[model samples]
Structures are given as C-alpha cells and as structure tokens.
Target: MDTQKLTIRLPESDVQFIKRFAEEHKTTVTEMIRRYLKQLQAQHIDEADAALQSITGLLPQNITEADTRRLYADYMMDKHR
Candidate 1:
C-alpha cells in the first residue's frame, strides 16, 4: 500500500517520552500511534454497539392498531400529569 508522510509538532518532553517508550517497546513512534488510533476506533465501535444493544428490545413487536392507540394514549396521559 502507498503511504503518505505526516509532520507533527510536539513538546520536547512529550517527544523524549515517546522516543523512550518506542525504544522500550522495540517499535517506531509511528507504529505506536497507529496502534493507539486503532484501539480508539475499536473502543468507539464497542461503545456504539453497546448503546444500540441497550435499546434493541425497548419496544415490543407484533402490536395491533388498537394496542398502538392505547400506548400513545397512555403516553399522552402520563405526559400531561
């Protein structure tokens, strides 16, 4: 795959820390950043999936027209109370 170059400015302390971390891990800072980004993306996907799962069964299926009307009526009544 083709790759592009990116330039970023960091504080001297951060740069030193990243260099030490990369040396300790036997990986380049670029690879470390890429791994971190992948982790962040995975975390977001997990959170979104959890949110969708939480609402999956909030409403019942197989409701008739009468049931729908009754549900709406109850909602309106509760809203006004």
Candidate 2:
C-alpha cells in the first residue's frame, strides 16, 4: 500500500509511553497507530451502513432505486420550473 509520512507533536510523556509500549509488544508505533486508525474508519463505515438500513423500511417495498431516481428527477424539474 502507498504510504505518506505524517508529523505530529505530543507531550514528552506520551512519546515515551508509545516507545515503551512498542518495545514490549514487539511492534513499531506506526503499526499500532495504523491499526487504531483502521478500526476508527471501519466504525464510520458500519455506522453509515446502519443509517441506510434504518431508513429502508420508510420506503415502499415495491419501490426501487430507478423509481427513486426518476421521482427525484421529476421533483427537481418541478422545483426549477
């Protein structure tokens, strides 16, 4: 995967803690942060999917994506007329 360097400032204590933890875990700090950020990203995507699923019941079972698109197009045309 492509990677970019990021720079950040932290308290000396936090920096030391990360170093100590990384040594104990036999992993680099970069890998630790990568796992943390990936989990946050996954949570965001799961939340978005849940939001869409929650709204599905509000629409008619017989309606489809094409029907929704056509209806939205008609509404926009009327709105601008």
The local distance difference test score of each candidate is 0.94, 0.96
Backbone Cα, N, C clashes tallied per candidate: 0, 0
Candidate 1, position 13, lDDT: 100
Q: List model 1 lDDT by residue over 1-80, tens digit each.
A: 68789999999999999999999999999999989999999999999999999999777888788998999999999999
Give lDDT tens digits, candidate 2, residues 1-81. Answer: 899999989999999999999999999999999999999999999999999999978878999899999999999999999
What is the C-alpha local distance difference test score of candidate 2?
A: 0.96
Off by over 4 Å in 1: 64-74
47, model 2: CA deviation in Å? 0.7
Q: Largest TM-score belongs to which candidate?
A: 1
Candidate 1 residue pairs in backbone clash: none
Model 2 residue 34 lDDT? 99
